[model samples]
Target: MSDQLFGSWMDKRDSNWVVFAYFDWIYSSGMFIQMLECLSKRWGFGTDDVDCRFPDNNSFDVDDHFSGVEFSYGLMYDPDVVIVSDEEFGRYLDMACFKYIERTPGSAEYVRSMLSRNEPGNG
Candidate 1:
């Protein structure tokens, strides 16, 4: 309970990375590094681009949303941790993060890609 509330799972491989209500329990053992990679990869509008953030905190941020990050955020701010995101982006990113924590990132992503092609709006 305290670990969940305070993100102590980051220090030790104590808990799985379950972000919000978008997934099943991942066998993470603190797969937090994979979470950051997944978030940066599937950030709703990936154009295979990249950017760096120099936030006040000493944490460095990177993501593929470099093409329209300013437009997405309404400012030129690259948040170290994206605590604010619109609903669709947040949900999809969470899904990817969860998948990355599993043992089969590539296969899971392939499934998602196929599903996306069949989703209503894509056609």
Candidate 2:
């Protein structure tokens, strides 16, 4: 996406590129459990105790509500790498990250254009 478009996108959300980058890193690494925990803690769910099931310290048993919002954490000031093992889940996490990026303001068209450029057949 163009820098102008990306800038406009950033303007509309209470988010930073660093947070998005962390989302990318954690999802790619397959440490989605830690990602969710960090996000839940950030989102004030720390006191609620969601039934988060961490399988093998890598993946998290995230329900529908927790699937795609990890990029919005307010506490994680830095990014960390996660170790991934499942290819399909990894792809799913990657797609979810793209979706999060697309959901940001001024980013849908840019993201859509990117997807089309990357996979014309799928587009």
Candidate 3:
């Protein structure tokens, strides 16, 4: 969950943090779908807002022979506002990784830490 985990896929736009997490061929499409579901639930937005695409037979082939999955979400919560605090945003990422992704222990912590560091002006 370090900045390197996302590499060049992280950006900011209009006061929103756009984060992209990609899974290589080793992971299933179901995993990506589950991540979308988790994000929808956390943001109170529908999956319709998410855009997911996977490689197909007609798509260009790579050496890995694995179709990658990309999950992107825009974090629009204002941490300085009373409605949403920085801790809440961090907790959302933690819960998404823990409950939805079912990642191992400490995984959520790593995500939270990285996200905290990536916040605007935090770098």
Q: Count the backbone clashes (under 3 Å) in each candidate.
A: 0, 2, 0
Model 3 lDDT per residue over 1-123, tens place: 332222343344423233222322112233433443443333222232333333245546662133332333422342211122444444434444444335335455544454455344654
Candidate achieving higher TM-score, 1 or 3: 3
Cα misplacement distance, residue 45 of candidate 1 (Å): 13
Winning candidate number (TM-score)? 2
RMSD of 3: 15.5
Model 2 whole-model lDDT (C-alpha atoms): 0.36
Candidates, ranked, TM-score: 2, 3, 1
Candidate 3, superposed: residue stretches over 4 Å from native = 1-83, 103-122
TM-score of each: 0.22, 0.24, 0.24
lDDT of 2 by residue, 4-85 (tens): 2123222334334433444444444444444443432322211111111113323363332333223232234443222232
RMSD of 1: 13.7
Residue-level lDDT tens digits of model 1 in 23-118: 221122343343344434432321212221212233254532333222121123451122233344445444544555354556566545544543
lDDT rank order: 2, 3, 1
